[model samples]
Target: MSFNESVLGKEYLKYCNLKEIALNTKTLDLSNISWFFPTCLLPLGIFIKEHKEIHVIPPIDIEVAKYFNIIMKDKIDSVKRSYIPIVEILPNKKLIEKNLDSLISNKDYNMGSLNAFAYFIGELITNIYEHSKFSTAYIIAQRYNQKNFTEIGIIDNGISIPGSYEIKGFNFSDIKALEEAIQGLSTKYNDNEYSERGYGLRTSLNLLTEGFEAKCLIVSRGVGLIANKNNRFFYKMKEKDIFNGTLISTRFDNNIREVNVYAYIDT
Candidate 1:
């Protein structure tokens, strides 16, 4: 199957289709996909790695092929799993912090921006544990000195944003759920203290766009959002494929500095 942004969905069907293809075939071809999203790209990498026999045919799109090569470079040359282990359950916050610290330390970039990026990563991952019903989550990160940017991808196969809110008794469409999420609204009713709910996505976006002048792309269900320092916009997928959960990809400029990580996380 040719994977593209249009085939991205929030139901189990899309994932199932990929899994079926992987299981039945020794070599999975991706040459047909001209354009792609990290939401699908990251999880597809994880899925392929899990199934050792499956070989991926490079995408026809040169840029897409380059991205896959960069993110999975360690895997491309070796059979060993070099990337961080997939977290099947909520990981300990301290462990995550330690990992982030190590990840940041390896980068020769602005300390303040790195710190903010670390915080943003922590929050985004934490959201998966707090909000989703899924058991597994995948993260992939790469720093491109030539491109002068650092990219991080987090993905999960679970109940989507709208599905989670619906379970909490709020009826809304996928786009509405995404809109509310970016606005810092939560399905959890907290009359006395707003802090008790709904700060993950908004605060993470603030740190990325406002704090570091970064760019973020979030895809869930049938809606996708892209935000940067100057503006934020949303687009609907053409096929209405349910994605079962969420995928967030962020890119932070290596040149950014003077970020107030504490303030963003606290507020």
Candidate 2:
């Protein structure tokens, strides 16, 4: 009925079933999927990108359609400026700047620690283009006015953590690989200077969830690693039919204390 319920409730199974079918065939049917979480965007985009001839059916529900289009389509104007969409996964700061601009323009947000929020989002997105094989990616955001929380969702189409490790002469299950990644083990190393590549995911998770007491979710392949302040857990999902990229959802409460986002990535 509502957005969250439609996404996390029964429609989830429908989305999964559609995704499973799309894996074998070239058609992605979204007729049953009235909505989705940020976790779904990565696999959805990858499916479209991977199978060039794939047919995607937009949701029949008008409200859901609008939200879906806002995320999937790249349009910026007076009416739609509240959100910015990036269709290509490139190492471009301009995209990040656009996101920052959107956040500022949407006065509904309190924009606590704007600089830190900017860096937090920028670093995560940048990592996608730099590593992840850069196949395709998507970014979406939503503001919960009453709740005073802004959620940003980002995902990429590439070799997931487990797949990356497998390629590097090491094999680990999806859960194990996700744990390794969150623990700050990056398969990538910066070409110049000290290794600044690995800490982005871990640092952001710690700052946003631990420091600000926000909720976070990281989906890589078949598992979702979630953190809420001091507690961290996971959900096994999608199995072999999972997204090849990483998907992250960061929730920020407008009333939270300021954070020095840069200080978290000292490693």
Candidate 3:
């Protein structure tokens, strides 16, 4: 299959992804684009006054797609689709924790949610690090004031959900494989203890959505998790085969002020 077809799908779904967002939004009369390092404010002020949209998609491979999603979700009007690159996402706990500290800081998220966010990020990153071998990986985080929530997405261009299932010695043709992966029963690792004892994804799903409107999606495997919504883990692959990589996304309301991470501090 062609890269794009294998990567996304042959149908091209809707162009409302990241590529279009990056190019088109910049043309709008009210667009404000900013870059870090030097932190130029003059350009931001001019764009804000004259443009209709503002986006902050880092140059990193994975951030492109996530940046598009964040801007589109926050867009007040119509948004065009775009194609964004996926990056290598490592699973090291230290790297993951550092990323959380840098991206999802205290200024935006609350205490408990931040803690949960760190946990979820760590788990997802760990999964990516341990399972896939992609060269690029990134996590995109954005706050939605209208929805009173924050969305975080981790994308990688490694093994997909179905591929992950296949590696576990299960038959890919079996529809039950999807269910197994979604229910957290698949051979996530070669060792049973590592997969079973690993509470990253499981605990993340439980804590992030506890008594709140939270959702998680593993696009690499065509599986999704949603609480109090259309909560079902289904496959969305076009080919009868597996997926290109994975995208673990989660969203939670903004009711917390700080995160308690004593349990995971050592990790």
TM-score of each candidate structure, all chains considered together: 0.70, 0.75, 0.56
**Model 1 C-alpha lDDT versus the unseen true structure:** 0.64
Best by TM-score: 2
For each candidate, what is the lDDT? 0.64, 0.62, 0.45
Model 3 lDDT, residue 89, Cα: 41
| Candidate 1 error regions (>4 Å) | 1-27, 30-40, 46-101, 191-194, 263-266
Residue-level lDDT tens digits of model 3 in 1-267:
232332122112221132234345664222222221100111122223334455543434443333333333322211212111122244444644443555545455456765666566666776667666655556655455665665555666666656766786767643455455545663555544535524455555555554334655444544322332334444444443232566555555666445455443324
Q: lDDT (0-100) at residue 182 of candidate 3?
A: 45
Task: State the lDDT of candidate 1 residue by residue for 73-186, as single tens digits.
Answer: 442221112222223223444545544444445446566766776677677777777777765566765555666665667887778787878898778888898898878787
User: What TM-score would candidate 2 get against the native?
Assistant: 0.75
Candidate 3: worst-modelled 10 consecutive residues by lDDT? 36-45
Measured with C-alpha atoms, the lDDT of residue 18 in candidate 1 is 62
lDDT of 2 by residue, 1-267 (tens): 222232222223444567678767767767665555544554565566566677777778886666655445544233244343333444464655655565434554335466666677777776776567754666666555666666667777677767776776557778888887777777764664336566777888887886677777676778766677776776676564355577777666767776766567754
Question: What clash pairs does model 1 have?
Answer: 9-241, 9-242, 9-243, 10-242, 10-243, 10-244, 11-242, 11-243
RMSD of each: 6.4, 4.7, 11.6
